[model samples]
Target: MIERLQLLVAERERVLGHFLESEQREIALACHSIARAFSRGGTLVAYGVDSAETDAAHVAVEFMHPVIVGKRALPALAPPNDVRGVLRSGDIAVSIAHGAEPAPVRAFREQARHRGALTIALTGGDRVDSDHAFAVPSEDPQVVQEVQETLYHVFWELVHVFFEHPGLLDDACITCGDVAIQARVVAVRNGNAVIEKDGLREEVAVELVAPVDVGDMLLCHAGVALERVE
Candidate 1:
């Protein structure tokens, strides 16, 4: 068991090593896409189909989380949770799927693209060629799940750089106006938890509506919070 565990850790490191090796280029590509979308006044949308839902949420949280660079108070809209909600085109979508496009993601992308969003597809190693695929090139049967999860994070980390160092947009949002808004938490908070936004890390104000914790992606605006990012 110990040997297997060690092997797994090594393999995981190799995957990350590849990521680090290409960080500069990957960040360039990802930031370029993000800036292009933002230049057109686009929203960032994230979602996953079936089991990939968790990855979708992770992508959104990483972007919206405090101190994570492009950490906007902007609420990430997931179409499956609210079918009637709008996801217009020009929005950026970080989608995940192992082999094929999931139904929920397909539906959401359809709506988003029709509205004019640019899609960034993050697929598993098993997936066929995807122009938008952020390839990790791993085939560890014991760590398929880990690879899928990593794929989600690797892209978003690049997304963060896109907002901070801004290789592509060149800090376009520096002068952009803010959309003043507010929200309230719908649940509760236990232990040490806080709300993060706009590089301003503030402790979650309300408990009932501020049900978030470490690693959770929350939607915050004007002291009102809602829709945990998972």
Candidate 2:
């Protein structure tokens, strides 16, 4: 009995190590994509089969209510049973499947693709057909699920990094000042203004006292353009 338990622990560790080494780059790229989707007002939709159902729900709730204070809440949902008609264009569809990839999950991924949504598959199968696929590379179902929970948590954390450092993602090259940040107005659309600070640019909600135009300089705060700067 003792020998069997020792072997199980060793096997689990080996599988987790292999997964982390092999999937690191793919995981980074997926997190970047998820962050971009959220910035564009996209939602995360997760689905799973059998024991994975609870994981799907957990992922949704974590995004909707982050434990870390000051982190912005992002939208997420896990549909019970069928995921059909719930996904839309610009949304993200995450399918979590253990052992063989389930038929319904595969079909849902395909449908999401047709609707212009990003598809991510976490599975213990040969491979999942999607924009991004992470094969856990574990024969043991429990090991696969355990690694998957860690993977999704990592995803959630990394996605927030992009939000926190918008300047890094947007390649903004500007110095900050007391009270407000200086930016060049790049475009004005639908009552919001896209501003370039240094070289980086992002859309900011604005209620201009006077009309503003592209190439104007403005002061921004908390993603809102407060006033034009000389």
Against the reference, the lDDT scores of all candidates come to 0.53, 0.80
Compose the digit string of candidate 2's lDDT tens values, residues 1-230: 99999999999889889998998977887787688788888999999878988989999998999999999899999989778588887798998887778888788878787776777889995766665689988788899999899999999999999788775454332433356788887555545666765335466777753477777888887677778788
Q: Where is model 1 more than 4 Å wrong at Cα?
A: 19-27, 68-71, 81-85, 103-111, 126-131, 139-145, 148-157, 164-230
Per the 3 Å backbone cut-off, how many clashing residue pairs does candidate 1 have? Answer: 14
Candidate 1 weakest ten by summed lDDT:
183-192
lDDT of 1 at 46: 77
Worst 10 residues of 2 by lDDT: 168-177
Candidate 2 regions exceeding 4 Å error are 168-230
Clashing pairs for model 2 are 172-200
Model 2's lDDT to the true fold?
A: 0.80
